[model samples]
Target: MSEHKDLNKLSAAGLLISLGIVYGDIGTSPLYTLRAIFNTVSEGGQTINPMMVLGALSCIIWTLTLQTTIKYVVITLRADNKGEGGIFSLYSLVRKKAKWLVIPAVIGGCAMLADGIITPSITVTTAIEGLQVKFTHMRVIPIVLLIITLLFVIQQFGTSLVGKLFGPIMLLWFATLGILGMAYVVQDLSILKALNPYYAAHLIITNPMALVILGGVFLCTTGAEALYSDLGHCGRNNIRVSWVFVKATLILNYLGQGVWLLQHPHYDLRLNPFFQIVPEPYLLFMVALSTIAAIIASQAMISGSFTLISEAVRLNLWPKVRINYPSNERGQIYVPSINWLLCAGCLLIVLIFKRSVNMEGAYGLAINMTFLATTILVAAYMISKKVPRYAIIIFVAVYGAIEFTFLVGNMTKFFHGGFVTVMIGAVLFSVMWGWYVARRIKSRFVKYVEVEDYFEIISELSEDESVAKYSSQLVYMTNANFKTEIESKIIYSILQKEPKRADIYWLVHVDVVDEPFTQDYKVTFLIPGKLVRIDFKLGFRVEQRVNLLYRKVIEELVKNGEVDIISKYTSLHKHKIAGDFRFILLEKHLSKFSKLSVYERSVMWWYYFVLKKLSLSEEKSFGLDSSYVEIEKVPLIFVSAEDIILNRLPA
Candidate 1:
């Protein structure tokens, strides 16, 4: 829990960092949000009415107030897993409280990932396309593709260097938004009337096509979910304090855009409201700034995806992928497989859409679904904590209606490129669901043996002269949770298969807990100096490495005189030589002779396939050095095939 507390401090530095990381997606919305709305309202390339501008501004304001401020910053932020925030972190907290809660968790997680793909495509494309205003006939696609390719390629090297400049750049970006908006706001001060809620209600209630237009307006606050996801990075106090300045600047910019729209009612969609509001001489500079901001936003999304996949692997909802800690900074991870996959997806979206306006058709649909999923999980959590039922009901009803309306509005664009993102979400969800279910089925067949039944035999074996020594010390990785029990296959591997003899045998068990960044252990002596068991309780977010933890535990034991790891050889002991240690790792396979149902067979087949393709070797997964680690194959006999009738025959 102290891990999350570190991020909760309120300070000037924290606020600045929060500004850069938390607001990228939502902050850059002004670049294209209004243009998308105008395109939606008048399909025939006609000028948008001044009243529609007022209505659209009103909708954007209310949506931000209700959806972003009330639901996320105020309510959802309160649901923290020891200061860590995100759908997966929220899921870990409430999953034990309600069994079916995983459905919302998985859905929310997948939707957010799908949002990752479309967001970078649209944001980068919009920013790059700005150059088209001056350099007519210069192809935007090639430039956009180059920028995106470079963005993903740099992920492997980590972002700590470039990430430091993000805060100041974003601060300037917001300040620019405010100043530009204010300059235009004074030109037509009457545009401020959109601040009133009446115009928003009037537009949606009267306009026949308001629902379709609302879909495009939904993009204004799509990044609200990312704010909650990044809560742990900046802390609650820092985020809450920084949001005041962020929101104020955002509103001023929107008002400025509204004022500009009122004056130039006949402006083209290509002349985005965001850039048009800027001074004519600064257009090139603004375009450059927007591109940098968009890239920062893309970087945030990509990192978030890597974190989400890491958590999913720990929870058994996804396959294990290689996670690299490229920087010395804690929690900064790079997942190679996920990075390239996202790169491919982003490129596909850009090539298909060719421009930001077309990309808008697919953008908000996924994130709106994520918004609803977060609402459900947070409400479930509040109820589990015994918060007042009435308050929980109110929380659900208000956000539920707001998000549902957004979902409906987004559905208007379902066939018009919206299907692209939904299809991506479905694929991700299937992989997670399949992996999770298959793990549960495999766990049901695990068989454990009581340690008491073999304790005396193991003691005697240590003294036996007939058996050959495997090593001075033999260590095994086990799934057993209790000191008095171990996997049956371990007993078979020792007593029946090889008849291993050793001065000491170690049984190591790892338990992954719900907390983040927790790394603790307990030691038990099963047979005094002959055998021992070390139980490690690791948090889901912590790296699972037995070899490293094993060495630490050994060092502590030797210092305490609990066990001596000195060399067993007589001549080596006099020189104070360290004993040799070897580890045995088990890899389970579904047995061909087992009588499994068709469903079990199918799940296991896919499960092993996923593991082989996506994960590392058992030695690497355990962080064991290959030279000291030996791997053995074992069969998982869920149901023995008694149906296979065989009789004894003379040889």
Candidate 2:
């Protein structure tokens, strides 16, 4: 296998295009961040102090610079898995040494998923909200709904078509920010003084409502997780290079909003302050263009969510669902279940809130929790990896302090709106964690027999004239492990029913790794008797083509002197020495004996039933030829007291 590549290999031009597509979320925040901040302070047309607005704008600029730029781009991007970075990437890096931190990592990942839902809702809603400045009577909800519906509808087509336009459109979006902001900045150069950190410090320490303000301000950095998660897609250098332009444009636009606010203290630009800076005649066209831009931003997050969930499923951190790689491009995939789930959630959020401002109250919790979780994981990574102690201490202190403060600020909004986000995330995380635990328990109880024992049985059976005449080799495809319940069933079924065996016994186990590319076969020979066992670790990102791999494995075994190279395992062989394949499928049916709580049993049953319908067809999942493949279903019973209660409980 080739060594993993890094960001340095990409050309400068490729990096720029990658950045525009990957960093679109953080890049697009200027469209709504300033408007969100001012809306919080200027409730009901209340005249806000010019100094306060400047102070808030100053805080927004410095926060992006310090929290997003320095913290994420400079420090966080350095913590990557091969070249991938995300909550799971960081989790994989630190989980071995800092196992205790997995809880927080899981929580962070759950919150990031929640953020995925709310992002598109708020982004599209805010863009549509800008319509009021020009149309004055345009229906906002319908437009927002239409934009979101179209965003998801296009996801099935993959990103290649829209991806090319993402760079140039976002480039134009950032340029608009600069041009509009400069127009306002020239009117009052005094707004530049707010750039000093002291003003933000003063506002926080002196103002009683600073906590709420900070909570609102936290929305400005909501896309920081997107910056890290998309690292694999865009590469680290592309994101870093792109952020230079993205961040500068964001800061200038924010300062320009401050300049505009300072001049028009009584003006209620409740819809969107960013668009207010533009000339009135062009504001409608800007809204139309921005709605398109916002939809693109939302699309990027939706795509990123698909990739994250795909990785989660591969790592066994999340349950298996249907995953389709719509593009030959390395990381492009579409998960129908997740895509629809997010669309439904975003639609509900938009309908319930009816405005981006209401959704804003709920947005920061997921982002803050995700950031805090990442910091804790990063600190653990530093210590375990034997990085300099002083560096760990200093970095942790800086990041932890900011993270804690933001967590508290975000928590303040919990009952008001943040609770909704947390609840949704909790539901998802619980399902994933529950499934993981159940799988582990099932694995633990499985009976394990030595390969020597099975090989000895095969050796004895090979000598029997009746057994040897049936088939040349026995190939059992099983979902369970080599020594688990399925193995026993395979043995019993062969002896009691057919009463025949084959010349060779092949034990194969296939594991899906969370990489973009992987080899087809990894062979192991159990010694003394040289019992052949092989593991085929395939990449989840690759198509599951069993026949192709089987051919390669047969070739490899022949070269290794394990099998004859010339004998094809075709069904039409004249000597009737065709390879007999038995697929042992272990199906778990929940019963009163299963050891689950009443609630847990209900959840499991619900999952089981839903999965029965939604899961990929068994024939496809196994990559088997239906014409020749023989399948046997073996039922495994795992009973606990909870199952009894669930069965006895009234429906």
Candidate 3:
């Protein structure tokens, strides 16, 4: 959606929409959070008791308070770029100020994506695991696999129909969580005792597996970033207002689950407290509701991944792949490569781990890395925005320690499938880093020259009737920032590669800016009617449709007396027909003859590999039609070879 969506309204409808899109990830966590904690404690050989339950409940309450409430909703939400908010949005704001900020942005982006894999695997498996509550011998893996596969397959069609149902369904989901949780909660009013901070502290200090339990507690807030990422949709007012109700329901449910566990100290750790708290008649109904909500949660995760990759491509942090907007829904996109890749990951985790309890170990850890990276970026952003230094210090110190402890606790999970998410993050980060570094290296070598020096030559060639006419109109996509500056290769291409003349020369430059939705252009008649320059200042998120935009610019120029577009041929000029325009695109290749360092060689090797495999050619990427385009290869000389040794004697 356009980041400028009007989400500031406090109306009930806004809140309901917020309930659907914004809260899906965090709202559905109750289905599996306690179950994961119990599993972790049981596997750690720790005794489960009322004290432990109270402590765990207290930890969940405070974590939601400190991590989700204060840090993200209150602090990070303030860092939105115009109306868009995400790592890339935040990075775009501060990246110009700090060149190195790209590192953390890529890290945060990749880690968030790695977390995407486990969110679906764990939440979907957990909801399906509820089925075993009715059929003890049911094989849930097959069921989970089916659900996961269908989710991916339907992505191509888009989710407009079912997506509309998400709000009412999630509203129902949260209401049910409150009602069921409150029922058990009233059974023992004393269960409210867990709300005290002492129990949470006691659990962490006295219990041996407290850190592991805390790791599980983290799952409850893993989707907290989604709340912020979706800020543009629901607006801060709607989200902040709705979060009050959502958080209350979530906390009550956790407390009620604690109450159930306290009463049944001998309860099997594998049995879900979420389902058990519901009345017998509603057990099947509860499973059905949980499954639907889990799917919505998974949908939010998948959609967020698409947005992330799309932004990464725009920001040059990741390679460009085909982006499909199935419907006209803003921000609703489908990337086949990413979609199928995530589907395979979810399926693999479901097949190998085979249970939500197992997937939980692989979750949270990668998200914590995301949390930490965002914190780092936020700190830098705060500094850049001129927030008070003292306030920034306090903000950083408090969240820093909390997230680091969360990180250390989760570090223990590396050997136990946590390595999966971490490894995925590392690999994804490397590919992005490789792509980014290669660009920086190339920037050091690409040649630029003053177009003023070639203007006389170009004018002379244009009128030289002895030279062949290349086309009525000639366009070249440029890297030059100023009208006077042009790439040296463009000069060579016209003067040496194959000399040609044209009546009018068009230099089109498209600038991808930091904003999310900028599309303005400037035109300068460098030589009045004979030569013109069009500089398009487009936002990074904008599609690079230079062909269509160029046509539009030409029409404007023709109407404004800036230029004439009638063909040079006398017959076409009488009919008022437009001249033919051909675009020349420069394609760079790493020269086999050039010398390079090991790092430089590796970077270029992977850069070209990624270009061929992952990215569209400039002609296609820039919205140029192949029929009217010409591709010319240029050597990328990072370090030119020294003088060659004389071989005259040998010859």
Candidate 4:
């Protein structure tokens, strides 16, 4: 808790760390944003339109102010889940407010993840493409692929070593951006007029391909969602403070690019303005620096992806996958499956879109969907906070109109490789939706009975010398939320399946709460020492390491004389030895002949065949020791046998 507080506290180091993690995506936007916009407005053999240039620069400036600055940093940052921010974190806070909100939450999360794949591809490709200015025959694809491969490969070992360099390096990178842009901006004070709203409005009204140009303009703020997603890593205050500097540099750079366009109206449109602004002597140094900065940006996105999936799993919106803490750094995790999958996706994207110019459309389209999803969720969050009705309407109206225009503009790129990311988002959303609904469908058939009903029988069986002793202590995981309730299948396993006796029976229930790092538990001794129930209230970010947590609970219980762990055997009790603990993990398999609707069947098919197959087993996921665990296969009967008709004569 102190560590979390430290993260939120305002300090110079905190601000620098925020710059390293939160601003990478947006900070590096000058690489392709202006280039993409210029390419869009000045296609073919025409000199760049002066009004279009001003309008694009104006659009870029205001977009950052409204979308990135006010909407995310000011308003949405306050909608954090215990210092955590992201689509899943936001949903966790407001999910109970509206059941249907999950649709948009999942949509937003999937879109952000899709953005992760393309971000690495586009950033590295654009940075490496700078080399082409000096060596026109250089191949950028292989170099980009090699850099990405090494980046993903290092995820397993962790980045703590090199992560320290990120802050100072990005500091230099942004400083360089400001210096380079400021140098050119001073030459033409007239370019400052592009920051005006009139130029932006004029361009929209005059340009026939306004949507297409807006698509290019939207690229300037593509990293806004990423900034929000990383709110937990660097606290809201740190991000807000860092953004002041980051945004100023970004605006200066764009304005500088605009100034260059005006001065060299007849220069080759193929060459990047960002590169053109730098002195000839410093181009190679700038290229090297940009490449390193691009890697930092990619690293941040990859880390964000891991955090997103981890939260989704805990929230039960995604399948359980293996998560490893490769370093002691706060919130640093490496997901092997996610790592490889992202690598493959990035490599494929690089191969398909060899030039950064070609990837602009896909990148804009993907993140635009994410922004729209985020807008819906932020509005929901505001409503939950009881913000004024008028305020909510105005908020919705303003961003809704702005983001909807961006969406329509991005749609113009659907054929130009935008479908790739859209398709990826669709697939990801299907997986999340399927996993969530499958759990709901399975829950419909689950039977819960009062634990009080079995108290007498369980106590009797514990002392029944005729029955063989199962173990000194036996534990079964239950899905019941109430202390008095236990799964009917668990009761059957205890008394009906085999009259197994034990000194004590334990039922553990894990409840994932909305807060990010909450860890609390309640112990209820239903039948003295014979029957016990432990309810764990863990936050969405906490791992359910039941075995270790249970041990800690028992230590506290024994300290307070709540329970005993001494062996029941006369020979071992005298030695002060602990009793044997055995866990029973009930694995549910869908019944072959169970009845279900087409939609239910399809959801189950996706859950079981695809998600479940890829996920870890319950014991491993819950951090249980396999040596002390036993698996019990249970058939999930959606439609019971009583529902079927049979002829009496046939029997």
Q: Arrange candidates by TM-score, descending.
A: 4, 3, 1, 2
Residue 167 displacement in candidate 4 (angstroms): 1.3
Tens digit of per-residue lDDT, candidate 1, span 568-645: 779999999988999998888767624567876777787777655666777877788999988888887765666568
| Residue-by-residue lDDT tens digits, candidate 4, 103-164 | 98888888889978999999999999999898999988989999999999999999878888
Q: Point out where model 2 deviates above 4 Å.
A: 1-7, 44-47, 463-473, 477-500, 512-516, 525-531, 539-548, 555-561, 565-580, 589-651
Query: Which candidate leads in lDDT?
Result: 4
TM-score of 2: 0.88
RMSD of 3: 2.1
The digit string of per-residue lDDT tens for model 3 on 1-651 reads 433656565788889888998888899899888988887787777767888888899999999999999898889988877677888888888887888888888888999999899988888888888878889999898888999999999999998777888999999999999998999999899889888999989988988887788888888899999977887677888888889999999999998898888887778877988888988888889888998898999999998998888888877778878788899877778889899999998999888898787787899898897788888889999999899999989988998899998998888777888999999989888788988988887777778998888888888988888988898899998888888888888889888899868889889998878787789999987876767899999886777788999989888877877787788778999899888888998888876625667887887888887655677777877778999999999987655545556456755
In order, candidate lDDTs are: 0.87, 0.72, 0.86, 0.89
lDDT of 2 by residue, 502-543 (tens): 555556667765454566676655532223456777764455
- Which one wins by TM-score: 2 or 3? 3
| Positional deviation of residue 332's Cα in model 2 after best superposition, in angstroms | 1.2
TM-score of 4: 0.98
- 10 residues in a row with least lDDT, candidate 3: 638-647
TM-score for each predicted model, relative to the true structure: 0.95, 0.88, 0.96, 0.98
